[model samples]
Target: MMKRITKLVMVIFLLTGISTVNGQDKYGTEPKKCQQNLSLFHESVKAKNFEGAYENWKWCFDNCPKASLYVYSDGIKIAENRYKTGDKTAAAKLINDIYTQRIKHFPKNLGKVYSDWAKSLIKIGATKDQVFEKLDTAFKADPTGMSIKNLANFFQEVTDRNKDTNVQKVFDTYDDVVEGVNNKIDKLTKQSDVINAKDSLGKTLTSKEVKKRKNIGINLTALGQVEGVLDRIISKVATCDRLIPLYQKNFEAHKTDSKWLRRAVSRLFSKECTEDALYPKMVEAWVTSDPSPKAYIFYAGILEKRGEKKKALEFRKKAIDLETDPYKKADYLYRIARTMYGSSAVSYARKALKHRPNMGKAYLLIARMYAKSANSCGTDEISKRMVYVAAVNKARRAKAVDPSITSKANGHIRSYSAQFPSKKILFVAGVKSGSRHKVGCWIGETVTVP
Candidate 1:
């Protein structure tokens, strides 16, 4: 009986020991399966199931970093693809092998993978130091890519930020507290604060420093960012104010393409485009980069806004000359003849008909000009009547050609007819009875103050 009890106790110990061993190995058995999964990972990649490939690769790297080729090679390739497609998760998973457990295994290519992560951080607006920290981590793991030049460039930015920068002040302050370690013991921490970090600002600062640092500020201001800053404050600011010149200054520096400039201009004009100081040079740059007839048209409008009508008309004519189609050119001529002075109206109207024979407005312009010219003759009754009759006939023809002009042409006909009723000088000479200008033809009685 004692032998039987001893055997039972021994049997109980054996079962308990087996149970304890399994409990100790609870998380340890994962890697063997991870390696088996990694063996199938390349097939997943070949099958174009990138998610499966990444998942398996991630598991293998974390669980079994010794799976030599998969951790460094396949993981990096997928991470790059992740970066491009904006698949942050996929990208993180792909690089997680190099970043996490397997970094110590392959030290050389590991640093590059961290550099790649820093690049990703930059796209998302990480600060310079944050980027450098990751960059340093990569260098620590694999120092191959940690170039002397990169260190120098980054360190230069920090030093420059602390210097007496005469760049445009943002008028806003950003508080930054930086801690520096004084010695190699890595024990002592140095602390400092900086104020009013003058990043690219909208202030069109007129500094003696302006000429030198303008390019640096402009460089920081992207083609898009420059456009945005100019948009917000262009209206509330003055034209001949200090800022006017910087628009021209920066325009000269840009290697702008037509599409970007077009969008930028459209954005600027959507706000206070009529501001005298801004539009002229803005339009100038548009023409400078790409001189289309449309560019000249916009420039002409800007000139007109600045009360430079003569310059405006010159650009308008340039637009007309640049026009390829004769019909459009005729329209341009009509605009010039009607709105501007001299005896060109009759001739331009005739030319317009010659180019576009069915043009109705041409007949109206010619008739009006002739009627105007005729009535101006003081004593020539026959010529005046003849011109009046000619004017009436042409006005009638315009009415016949296009009914849309009849209402307008009739008003012109009535006004000219009443203005020169007799076309004869009134007998009284010293002073005209009514001073010549009349305010007749009221539909309602006028109000008089008592």
Candidate 2:
């Protein structure tokens, strides 16, 4: 008798379109209808019939909010189409809704979703605070997932908000963004290197590989732009005058903190603040606390500044040996080269090339070294001008290897080419324009007379 009564009540509830809370599934009550709508919407969206998809999509969205992630993803496409067709207000609202619901149902890729949301907000002329709110969340969740442009914009927002009262926060944000960008660039560079090597061996790439190479190039270009923006934004506040006092004030508190010491040392070194009284003290503390490769490099710089060349080179070698990453090792070699002169500097730059063949800065450094030595390199005007030929050759190589430095390398090429031997001078010296000539002295590079 009890079983019969329960069955009757359940039948009545079903007939009356009522379901207990515990009995509800992700597809909601009347799941067959909800699933039908989901299928109908999906098919319509696939056919690019957004108008046909809309009603059914809305039904699924309202009735079965957690049915599937595709509901929101496909909805975004519909909304974007609408946005492009002049349904500005409604489309933006729907897109925001999709982002919110997608995040609620599927929390994966939270950072990317928030960044996309922020970008959408920007397009609709949203206030800075509104845009920043989304960006801040995105940056905190997963900075690596954010686009290069978004990362740079986030840093700018951070700087504007904290520059006056909390300048350290601004600096920290800059470091974080730069580190993220460098990490991404490093990964892409390794992949690009592999593709480049295969191409050099005359192996044909697949369609997918070719597309990937193109994308990597585009991304590298964007990342390079972001880096330039970051430097420009930080340069104003990162001067030695500003950095000296800032570090001086924080040194007492951060002396024993290795991470803090490293950043301080790096910033000071980059700003060329090594002559200050506080620099040595900070370096000593940093080395004592953590004698890492970078610490040793800074220590070497100080030693060289104090006129202890032999000791400096010893520490630089120590730094090089301690570093395990070939890229970092190359960077340290370049830094050491920057402090040297003439042939020695060129030698160290070449060593850097052995580790990272795509390093354009090393080539640029060599070109500058050769140009500076032109006067001392030759006794005659024609011979002196031949050094510029070698310099131009190096600048051209720099431009070819690294797209990021194209403009800078072109400038160098132009400057060097201007100093090429005049037509009459070449004739008087019996040097044909296309004839090979060896530049003597420190730079012994052979180049065609131009």
Candidate 3:
């Protein structure tokens, strides 16, 4: 179905002549002349003959700016080669012209075009501010369409600006950009899930679909890297002391603005500032103004803090029940799990998995919990290290199922596997490497020792 839809969209583009190179009549160039230049440019580009491509590509750019996108595509290649060969000035101007023409021809795709433009500028050694301006324009125009690099870089630049006296801009950009990255990650993960679902049903993907899945994996991996970078950038600015005073100063003025209040309160909660007096007040105000599932979660936190365990559980359940999207419900449950102590975190994480089976991070979370409880799970060293085997099993499962976190999960598996009791120690205990061993305590999963 997805392939059919993709082909249909391609057909539409072809029908509209958007995919043709010879249809540059609107640029006032003769069709035969345009075709000749386009053909020559493509042939040269295909042969890696940037110098040979340059003259023909230049004719298309000068006389037929509205030609097919490949004109710009080949032009960028030529420009990059020229720039690397020391003609930086000429190359920069031509690359900039390519972007301008592409935008003029396809104004609707400004976000992505501008992001590409910003990336080109970075390649040419453009100043940070120049790159930032282009990325900022791209983000504001269409954040979800922007690349992971742009999204993360924009936040970093905004943080730089915040230090120069626009602190609120940093907060605003972080909120918006992080949300955009999450949306993109969710979108790509769903694409992979579709392919994985088919595979699970014994329907192997065609070669084309396999390629598509690989691309999705590549994109998810890139997004995961940017997410870590963004977190590191924000961590420097989001300290509890810095956050509390900043929120305290604006709390009264923005109390009625639920969006603002929620952002403030959520930031505070994430930074573990819930003990502050302002946290409960903001939670109450958020519930009064919006009553969203997120707001209910904050209110639940307030209840938990007051030692009202039963009431907190009820509000938390209400929050989870109010959420209709399985992914989001799982996210709320995951958060609840993060906030909980002892064995209950694993239970909440399991509940999250019940709602969304492909949430590999949930498995990772469970593994971490089991590892944390290893010392108390058994009295003997051998029995305790058996918990590492269970932890490693979950991490391995996560890597097998989730492409987005495959790298991280594999790292966990390696680290935990190393911590497992040596084969010599296992042999002394009458255990074989391939034999099954039950990990007692809250983690009842059986794992094969290595």
Error of 1 at 273 (Å): 12
Q: Identify the runs in model 1 with alpha carbons over 4 angstroms from their true place.
A: 1-290, 294-318, 375-378, 419-450
> Candidate 1 — worst ten consecutive residues by lDDT sum?
172-181
| Residues 148-180, model 3: lDDT tens digits | 778778877788877558677788887886677
Model 2: per-residue lDDT, tens digit, 1-450? 999999999999886664555335678887888888989999999999987798999887878888888788788877777887867998888888888888987898877889988988887778999999999999888776788678778888788888778889988887777777778777887788788889889999999889998888777766656667888888877888888889899999999998888888888887788889999899989999998888888889888889998998899999999899998999999998898889999999999989988778899999999999999998899999889999998999986766557767889999999999999987787778898899999787788887
The positional error of residue 50 in candidate 2, measured at the CA in angstroms, is 6.9
Q: List candidate 3 stretches off by more than 4 Å.
A: 1-29, 144-152, 406-411
TM-score of each: 0.29, 0.80, 0.88
**Candidate 1: residue 365 Cα off by (Å):** 2.4
Clashing pairs in 2: none
lDDT of 1 by residue, 149-253 (tens): 333333333334532342112111000100110111011000000011131344454464454344332322221122223223332332334333434555655
- Model 2: lDDT to the true structure: 0.85
Ranking by TM-score: 3, 2, 1
lDDT of each candidate versus the true structure: 0.52, 0.85, 0.83
